[model samples]
Target: MYLTFITMIMTLVGTASSASFSAPNKDLMTCTIAVGWMGVALGALSFVALLQLRVYGYINTFIWNRKPTGVYFIAPIIYIISMSILYAILSFVLPLNGGFVYNNITNTCVAQNVIYYIGLTFMIIQTVVLCLLLFKARTIDSCFWEFRKMLLVASVGILFGIIVLAIQHVHFGDDKVAVKGILVIIFTLLPQQVYFYTILGPPVYHLLRHREYYLHEFAAIVEEKGLAHIYELAGGCPLGEISDLSDSGKPYRTTAVNRLSNDSNFSGNEPAPEIGAPLPRNSNPRQSGPLLSYYKSLWNRASRNN
Candidate 1:
């Protein structure tokens, strides 16, 4: 958690510094320093999440008796170690142009090529391993699906940026590629920042503010509903059939409603209740299940406490 907080602070600092020093006539050393800081901060932030995920899995296994597959435990450790080694090697090998006078264009280009290749290699490896680990974990637990999707989107954006940088490096002689690559990177950074905040910010905030409450609520729901039903509640499509019904310009009825109406238990020609209407008093608890019940209880508790 301290690492996460530090990462956020570093990211903000780096972004601000980059924006301030991004002018065409800006000192190259300053720009490089800002970029390097941002890179290290983001890299650390990325691995911190992996460590957290591993910790979460350990908790699930020991406390909840919900053991994730072995791969979930193993893959993250491998990725963290591999990435750490790669970063260490790159740090030693890559040259930082710290406002120094380069003797020639050749030396500058060589440094640029080394940094570009090292960064690109790290990105490729990180993307592949992280995606695989997340995907595998998602298969083991549906709750991770959102995390998997968000990470995949971010990875694709990064892969695109890396490709642009690669092109820039390969055509080092062409000023056009360098300009295009810089532009692409700037364009990509905005969306990636938005993605990070939009997808991750709320959950992190909630965890920080209501950590105990959130955990208790989750445990209650999982206990009450059973894991399979909880999974469905998390991932199920409540309005999935709405699109099909919309094409025919008919009011959408849920499968549950149709089944109830057809049964001897409910023999009314009366119109089905509105989509968002509350269920009847005698409605099956199994339909809505514990997830909904947990939310209601949580809301009531909050209201009372306030």
Candidate 2:
């Protein structure tokens, strides 16, 4: 979300300046450099996201053994801040036309210096790293499969955008309309498409069309992998309930209890398991976080509906 917001701001500033101001305009030059710096920042953030995903996959498989430290989170913040500053400094300090290239056809100032390509090259390296990481994590289970798919598509988009920018600089310099259109596609449409197809589209389709099956699969995976504690990191489920389910090694199901209580054959004299009751004799100790309570609520709703 931060990346998205920053990207939009950079894009708006650059686009507005480009459209409204002419060459040698101070605001235009400033926006151009800002755009370059933000682009590098975006690449840095993208790499961080990939690293986080890999870490999450590791956590899922061996969370207790390889739990992340504060450094894991703090380090990325430091890297991004430092890199953004370094990129901005280089853009201004370099002697190549103040790091701004003039477009004769569009009468606009843009950044196409060696420093800009250095940032672009950094993005290329990040893409290569993404491919290597994806290859390494190819055998990971379904927990990360969707994210891997998203990264694959994102890698392709990044590469395509880089190629388009390179081509625009070298060959299509005179075609203003084509240049602007490609920029819009690269900066805006490509990301929207990748995110929709990889993240948004699949989940929504599953929820709308295969909700029961989706929930069942989620329950099965959570149960089998002892991943109830993972949701504790996401701040929805209660640690006590998660620990109960994890310790018992059972997916929480209220169906049987609901059925027994609702059955006409059941008499009030007999004891019935209460809905949402925590299991007994749970002894798992690492239970201090917000977590898997959403699934519990989900189960509660499912039970009441039935």
Candidate 3:
């Protein structure tokens, strides 16, 4: 999300620079040049994000124990920033497109082809690597479907962008408007689809349809802890700690119940029942199962006897 916001801001700055190109201000032109390189930097950062996702997928899919830490996480951002600064400096010192040129008709700064190709290479290589990683990562738990979908959309979008770039380079090279329009369309749709499929769509659906799922799951964990405490007081072994749901290598819905049944080390045919316990089972019939139904039956019998 932070990356998304920063990229959007850079894009807006680049757009504004082109929009106001008629002005004779050197400051704006300088801003244009800087933002152009920033665009390349942003692309590199985006690829870094993709690589991070691919690594996460590997960890989850293979259940790798030792994960990346400290320097592994921070180094990429630093590298991209340093590279962008280096590129900016070199643009001045070297004959990279002889520095940026402002095209009057397009109202945009034409950045160095060398820089453009470097950025394009970054996108292509990362996209291909991510797609290969996805074949394995797709087997990762479905709880991460949103992230997987986000990665998939990003890869597809980058692939499409490459195609667009090829077409623009071959046929529309002389037509600035055609090139700009094609780019605008690709960029616009790519972000919007990513936002919908990953960020907005799933959460909104959960809100509307399964509104109580999160609260219910949290309550179940609390109840499980309370039950464990009670069992400990009753001279029995305390229930094992609830595993972190995020770390669970199972489907979201069954994780808690499965953890309770398997990890609690209960030896009996029945669950540990506390006197005057709050109902922890979900009230929704569809979500209820044999264990929850038994709890409900116990509650009902207790209510009548009371």
Candidate 4:
């Protein structure tokens, strides 16, 4: 549940950041929106399942022969097809009344039923898949340990939450207001708290520490494409400023073509100059920064060794 919520929030953040920082191509925008909608659907379904579990003491699961194939396999196929059609209809309808009609549509009986059924299906499928993955994770290769740890942490947190809810159901008997309040706090709030510390916190800190790397890479791409103007248009500092602060250095220019043409010592098909050829004397002054100098030195050393 917490994983789905985090996924949805991250998707929204990624989409918004992409739009703000650059002009996404049509295909990129389409893919981004598709991922965002899928996350939203999953998050919504998880929330609904929690509520149903709270009310009914059990979640409806579609099992056959004590296996979860129906939950893990058939449900996802149905969800993808249904959501594709549903989103197509929504895209056509959403703009018809400046979005006011969305309120009415959401309030309708058909909409409520669809939400209920789809949410139930999604929750069951996700829960079953998560358990299966956790069971299989122990035997997976060591290369997957990082991912396995994350899954294990989240799965344990969610399982703990389920157990707490069940205990409350057995002890409190649904009639006491005080017990109801306790149930809400334990079931709704505790799991999110657990997830934050165990699953979400470390990556967020790592991203904050290394954010400059992402900015540097973006600036390098912009410089390569001669799209510095686009960065300015997006309300970012000019590429020169970013390059100075991030020390990304100028993109490399090949003197190979010029050297090949001019050097009388070289034949037409002498295998291209080794990759670590020294920069021309006329190379950009800005490329004299530490980042480029280090790379150049490393390359020259490798070429000499070869």
Candidate 5:
């Protein structure tokens, strides 16, 4: 599947790089437009594979979650749309007549109103969303956003190039490809940054921030004592979904802390009750060990329920 996708991209690139054959720019333009729309055709299959990976990487199959688990997840949909639009432009819009350089019209106009305009718009949107996701990722876990870190940097460069391209479009009206010098620098120099943030960044962020308990400096601090007291203090807000841990959901956080009330007494054949119990600091130095053990036992039972 991956090979096929690459081949398709190559075919388009072949048509796009008009320095070719007995074929004229018009023929190359016609083929390129036709080839690019193949992305939309393959979008369903690609979407399924990506969705499965996201689901499997998250909680188990027994669990149900929303369509998108995190903000960074937005990148894929944007990519799909961008590819679709970009290919459509290349395949149908044919060659651009001209382009701009800063405020100067470097190339003369070729196509009427270039479809690349739409493709460029999609690319800009994708780049912006990716940057925002990377910037906000530091809140969950510093390491969680690592995958996007490079992408964010790359997106900056890509966006700058796009801006120059857009400036060309403004000046020259998309007749020819503009920013050749800059695109040459960017497309090769920062490909990894582009690919990494788009593909590898989100999952890395999720894995890094997967568990709140794993992050809290207090987790290590309390481990020296015992597990129950730790849970007693911290078990309320689940480590399950860090995305759900935002400050905006004050009620949910409150409910999480107070969830024991929902399952106060063990009811089903599920298991025995082992809920975490809160304790007063000064009042329970002696009880800490046993209490920690109790909470740990409860956590084990709850894990079975989930």
Candidate 6:
């Protein structure tokens, strides 16, 4: 549940911080594609970090399964590679430049294809992962499955767009005027400009709002309060399982107790994380100290040495 909340917050941050600013020399289409890829990288990094937490049995939520879903890691990898190739092919096969090599404000159709495909690929990967999530819910309790509801909303939008692209690829043979126009506008506008902007940067967004480190807070809270007790109170779900903390759209379902969170355990016995089992740092520089300050520190050392 915490991770899911963090995910949504990260999406919001990505949308808020991402600028439409482009390089003067680089095509605007490519620029947009590059920005989209950055978001994908950010999302992938976040997924990997959370997956690591699961592997280490750090989470106390209940929605997660007993075993770390290898799917969590596998899906993202396949999606990124497949999407990259798809984007590359689309860029060359059907130019988004109004069917001309250089008719639109951006570069040739191929460049636009490259840019649009990156976003499209992200959309597809998100959808597939979400669908897998939805299916996994049937095996768990309703309370543990609700967090995925918001995930469903985000995934649905992406899936809808992918369906459109698939049909366009078939009917118009992947390069028809109506299909390309409809696709570029749909992907770049609806989900790209709005939906994705809303869902891609939840962790950063949460930090921006709280002005405190969330990951640290989660660990600290678990340490101070004791995750084992929390787990027992949370219904003794199991090690490495998260409970669903999603709402049911009912008045009775809005409370935190009703929300099902995934239940993964912290240290079970012998020793606790507080005695000092801090999760190793993952090196996300954005939230870290200033790079300029680091450079300054290094330069001072160099001057002294000279």
In the range 144-202, model 2's lDDT, one tens digit per residue, is 25446646666656766666566545644445555664464455445545643554455
RMSD of 5: 12.9
State in Å the error of residue 84, model 3.
Answer: 4.3
Against the true structure, whose TM-score is highest?
Answer: 2
Q: What does the lDDT come to for candidate 2? A: 0.46
lDDT of 5 by residue, 67-175 (tens): 3335435554565445555445454545434221111233211223344454455545545544554443333222133223444544555655555455444533334
Candidate 2 residue 238 C-alpha distance from true site, Å: 17
Model 1: how far residue 14 lies from native, Å:
5.9
TM-score between candidate 6 and the true structure: 0.34
lDDT of 4 by residue, 117-225 (tens): 4433555565665555444434422211323444654565567556644643464432453454444344444444554454445434433454334333333343333
- Clash count, one per candidate: 0, 5, 0, 0, 17, 45
> Model 6, 47-145: lDDT tens per residue?
333333332232223344233347654654465356535533443445445211332332222224544555555555555655554454433333222
Which segments of candidate 5 are over 4 A away from where they belong? 1-31, 34-79, 82-112, 142-151, 159-189, 193-306
Q: Which lDDT tens digits does candidate 3 get at residues 1-306?
A: 345556655545554453334456544347436445554444443434434454443443234322334664456446445645665564455453645566666655565676556545655665565566566555433333434665666666666666657644553344556455546545534653564355545545554554345424433443533332221222111111112232222243233343344433322355634433433454453345333444344445655765
The TM-score, computed over Cα atoms with residue i paired to residue i, of candidate 2 is 0.60
- Candidate 5 lDDT for residue 109: 15
The runs of at least 3 residues in candidate 2 whose Cα sits more than 4 Å from the true structure, single-residue gaps closed, are: 1-28, 42-65, 96-98, 101-105, 173-184, 187-189, 205-213, 224-226, 229-306
**Mind giving the per-residue lDDT tens digits that candidate 1 earns over 98-186?**
22122232222122455545655665665565555455445444332345545555565556555645544465453353454455446
List where candidate 1 sits over 4 angstroms from the true fold: 1-34, 37-89, 92-111, 151-225, 228-306
Which model, 4 or 5, shows the larger TM-score?
5
In the order shown, what is each candidate's alpha-carbon RMSD?
A: 13.3, 9.4, 10.2, 18.3, 12.9, 16.1
Computed on alpha carbons, the lDDT of every model, listed in order, comes to 0.42, 0.46, 0.46, 0.35, 0.36, 0.37
